[model samples]
Target: MARFQTPLRYPGGKQRLAPFITEILEHNDAVGWGYAEPYAGGAGIAIELLLGGTVDHIYLNDSSRHIYAFWKAILTDTEAFCRRVSRASLTLDSWQKHREVVRHPGDHDILDLGFSTFFLNRCNRSGILTAGVIGGLNQVGRWRIDARFPRNELIKRIETIATKKRRITVTNLDAEAFMRDRVNKLPPSTLTYCDPPYYARAKRLYLNVYTPDDHVRLAKFIQSKLRRAWLVSYDSHAAISELYRKRRQFQYSIQYSAIQAYEGTECFIFSDSLKIPRDSALPYIAQALRQPA
Candidate 1:
């Protein structure tokens, strides 16, 4: 019997407390259910679901092409990816080379280049391999990855996970389109875990903007479609609450300190509608929410 230990390669990934996400699954007995993620930034939750054997199949979607390519590479290529990352120097010139490869990488080396680029992106400062511009506190505003980062270990872990590729599906599309299609395509046992883009007042490089209206539309869409599913993770503003106000669900604000920005208690929203049985853990969810900030 094999196990999964590799963490998701993103800045705000929930690897630190995968238990919170896992608790939701364990309580619901969600294993073997179809796991769908609308915003598959690093596939952190999705990968955890896969490794936990909670989901027989996964449907992952992200609006970013670069992210999608990275997923594909990890699933299909490991050794070449390691070599590329090992050879990539994190200087300004090397970063530009990475960006170029990301922009127009040919099919001959899709898997290796994709994974290498994504690895460098995460290993780099700010978790983006865009440019060498350093800014902000905690270096949240720079792209830096030393050549000595653990590229070999990443390759080994990715290779191990790639062996179980029969049960995963990856897509690059907007969050709404993936949900719309799933409504008509999937069975009733599927579960969705949404961690939408943050709605805070800040600026960063993202593929697109998910406005307050977008959040409302997605919440409504999730409620109307899936017969037996739950949405977990952060919500943007009060838009998610307003969308789910009609339906009774447990909502919580988890305080998390961002390592990149040294910011504390960035209130993240968790909206869930899993008809949980009378259990001991449910009260704590509310208790944590009500405790003064």
Candidate 2:
């Protein structure tokens, strides 16, 4: 089916980062790498790559069990899960009904049930993982099912299906573990798009206790392991800006809001410690980096 039939409703999702992703992929002619997004949420980027046929292999991961479960269901029981989703009326009453329909079915993996539960997640007033579980817990807690199905233009797009032939793997792992441990197991040419938790806003929703130190560690890790792998990261603090600036990397600044609060600039870095691909135009910030600051 279409790599994704629904738009994910998470703060700082790579939905807006799609354009930059295309640019970077195009610039590097990075159309054949094994794609990995350890922080996969809503599978936005992974699905995009699937549709564009950018990568021959895909690996998606999200620490959030709710998200991981949703993916499991879609991949394994696509038709049945879609049927359940389509039959359910998109009202609050229907929400409970659908929840009950899929709730106790042990034939499928809990991850599958979790994937089927995201329909309500996108519209929940709090926009957190509170719904679709038993007792409302934070990201760590179980999910409770509630909320309406997708509607309007976006949902219509999601209903379209496209088949993918590439090998695809999904998991629930911390981003660094996937990069540090998993990358070594892959072929020499693989691409890792890390939409890690935003350093500024939306950090709490992403990780139980993400701190500034985590961001520094992540950057250091990326730089160290980037010799053979290509990576794309979105971060915009001065420290982030300065860290890569020192490495002679290209960084693009874009503005977007998170959690309905508009603030800060998101800086995207294009790095592949390999020789810069010479085919495409230089990245936007390449020339800017040549100049002072």
Candidate 3:
């Protein structure tokens, strides 16, 4: 698969991990099956897997209003969304303008807010909406603000993704609510990918920051409540390691971005029923987090 089938450049996005995920789906004979992501930040893996024909249908949900609006508009109002993207002004001035639109999205329609969010995500550092431009405000840095916001390519991605509107289900729902209301209804053969906010760095990275207790609650729900075959990814942290210490888990490092790129450790926990692959794909050398005691 071509690297980065999605338009957005999300920090810690799992576009690189698509191959490993594909291998897992293949190992389990889950190709052409239903796929889901409850905390669908950028939906990198979901987008690649579905578009590459690894899965026939995919479900994506995010609690963030702007994220939900963005996905909704992209699928439902494809032409208008692409037009908005095509016509976007790529400058520090336009970045500030879009920032305001993103901050006060209630005043505008979903499509407008969605496009503004897209604009900021592309123009800003690490695709973080709250972060600043790709280069400094003076535009004297190595890259300009428009360096990443390639209008034509991004528009093509939007249009292409919109083509699969029928096969994609997008929603604005809490992860717990999504599991209860949406995922519970999918076929037993479905494989759900749960890439939740990194507990160690979520406060700085996401608007919907999770408390320590919230992490515990999510762990309980995933271990006890989620009935279908599911896999979860999280930045490695002691708390998270403790939470899934007894489950089937693997450890590896990924290139994560905050203000800059850094090698960050990550862990993947699989449900009890699934078979762990004998080895992980390249670029992600898997080591056992710990064998279940």
The alpha-carbon deviation from the true structure for residue 110 of candidate 3, after best TM-score superposition, in angstroms, is 1.3
lDDT of 1 by residue, 112-172 (tens): 4565467456555456544332332233433334532555665666776687777878788
The number of the candidate with the highest lDDT is 3
How do the residues 1-293 of candidate 3 rate in per-residue lDDT, one tens digit apiece? 23587877778888788888888898898889899999998999999998999999999999988898899989999999998888877877888888898999778888988888888888888788998788788888789888887788888888889999999999999999999888988999888899988888877677678889988999999898888999999988888989988897777876676677789988889998777677665645544422332
RMSD of each: 4.8, 6.5, 2.0
Error of 2 at 234 (Å): 3.0
**Candidate 3 overall Cα lDDT vs. reference?**
0.85
The alpha-carbon lDDT assigned to residue 289 of candidate 3 equals: 28
Q: In candidate 3, which residue pairs clash?
A: none
- Model 2: how far residue 226 lies from native, Å: 5.2
**How many pairs collide in each candidate, listed in order?**
3, 14, 0
Among these predictions, the greatest TM-score belongs to 3
The digit string of per-residue lDDT tens for model 2 on 1-293 reads 43344456665566554544556666667777777887887667777766666767778887765676776655665565556555545455655543553445454466445644565555343345433332232323343333334344343443432235236687877778877778657886777777777666554455343577887788888887654555556656777776566554444544444435654445556564534433223344444445443
Output the lDDT of residue 109, model 1: 64
Overall lDDT per candidate, in order of appearance: 0.60, 0.58, 0.85
- Order the candidates by TM-score, highest first — what do you get? 3, 1, 2
Clashing pairs in 1: 31-54, 32-54, 125-144
Better of 1 and 3 by lDDT: 3
On lDDT, the stronger of 1 and 2 is 1
Q: Give the per-residue Cα lDDT of candidate 3 at 40.
A: 90
